[model samples]
Target: MADRFHEGLRSQVAFVTHTRDYRSAEVLPSLARHGFTTTERPHDRETERLLAQFDPDLVVLAIDPRHDDDIALVRQVARACKAQIIVVAPGPHPHGLALALEAGADVCVRDTDGGEMFNAQLGAILRRKTSPIEQEAEDDGPSTITVRDLVLDFDRCQAVRNGESIPLTPTEFKILAYLAKNAGKVVSPVEILRAVQDYTYSEREAQEIVKVYIRRIRRKVELDPAEPSYIVNVRGFGYMLERRSNRRDAVRASEAA
Candidate 1:
């Protein structure tokens, strides 16, 4: 779609369309002007070949509802490449939208909209594509911790809950951050003490001090301090931040609903 304000910058994008109608003509030129090298593919084989060769940053599938095979073609493209996909469907149908999402279309647009809206949607999708890899790298990197809504910003020395700032004392923050970063894995009181404090102490003393600080930190963060959600006592082993259980429960609830 044409965005008059758009300044062309080189970004590779692939378009899969079954027809060469006026609408397609209008859309392709705008994409080219925006610094995209557009290639039109009519079949799945051609689409896959183009994707493998050009290695596009995004794939836009303009589906023709008349062709039932178009849906299958979309699924093929999704499986064959890792590019972020945007599907343009003819109308608003909940089933079709769900199918598109299931087929790995990151975003879907109904053809009822004009070019401006389409351009804006395209821009937003591209932005998401660029950011997610960086986010995933950060998630996979060491020294980062995530538990439910809480995220310990190690570099910033702060804890955040659903984007809201949560204040914590230096000692409390370090202790929680360490536990969360090593989530789902138990760390003994001695190990925690060594990590958070430099002073040498007996294992018994370390266990006692770590327990007290953990309890205090839990009271400040946990929704139900008595029935902890993020951090859990591992009894024989020590303490671990439970993340998988919460995620599993959420998935189960969604499936049930």
Candidate 2:
């Protein structure tokens, strides 16, 4: 099992759901099989309080079709908690999943998926989360990529905006690297889906999936996300990142200074 496969995460897990008994009966046992100390919480105002007390390594939150919060609850959970989030969407609500993703949850899984599936997927996600840090430990190669005032240091696994750190999720970092590497050209979502996600998505799915990521990325990199200077959206096509700095400009600025 992936839980055993990745021993670090077998310690603690918390699940918040309206259908607690139905889901937790299956989920808690699966977690126990992999040696997780699990907690169950109601999908109510007390969710954050319960989670804070548990302080789990991972948090699994379910969005029931019955009650919906105006993205506020999710934003609060994401901001208040230090754990990685996995939002469980009602089987029928893809938009809810999209909203959760936009709110900065690490991932979303459908209600139909079993707990074991979540365990495997979460393990892979956690592994990816740690990879940049691992790479940072032995970054004898090039450590920094500079684009104007925005600098990404692979050695430190961080992005700085005019010396201020701009935090990025792992997916955001990978997508930025791909776009920066292919700067000055329209990169279709199909390309990003295949490159970043390792699978091809239908154009509609690709756009929907990639747009949420783009929105998040823009907020981090663009001076004004409402009117972006760096990442230009081609109306019917994909996206193009205008090169933020020229090497010659850098040389000239250095000489003048």
Candidate 1 versus the native: TM-score?
Answer: 0.49
- Write out the backbone clash pairs for model 1: none
lDDT of 1 by residue, 1-257 (tens): 13312332375666555532325754566566566877776554566777788777667787743355766766787777766666777764545644654444555565765565567666554443223334445554554467778888765667887888776655567678878868878788888866654333356655555666676677778777776767777665678777864534532232110
TM-score against native, each model: 0.49, 0.73
- The list of candidate 2 runs beyond 4 A from truth reads 1-5, 12-36, 65-67, 112-120, 131-133, 136-141, 193-201, 244-257
Candidate 1: misplaced stretches above 4 Å? 1-11, 19-22, 64-68, 129-145, 148-257
Number of the predicted model whose TM-score against the real structure is largest: 2
* Positional deviation of residue 146's Cα in model 2 after best superposition, in angstroms: 2.1
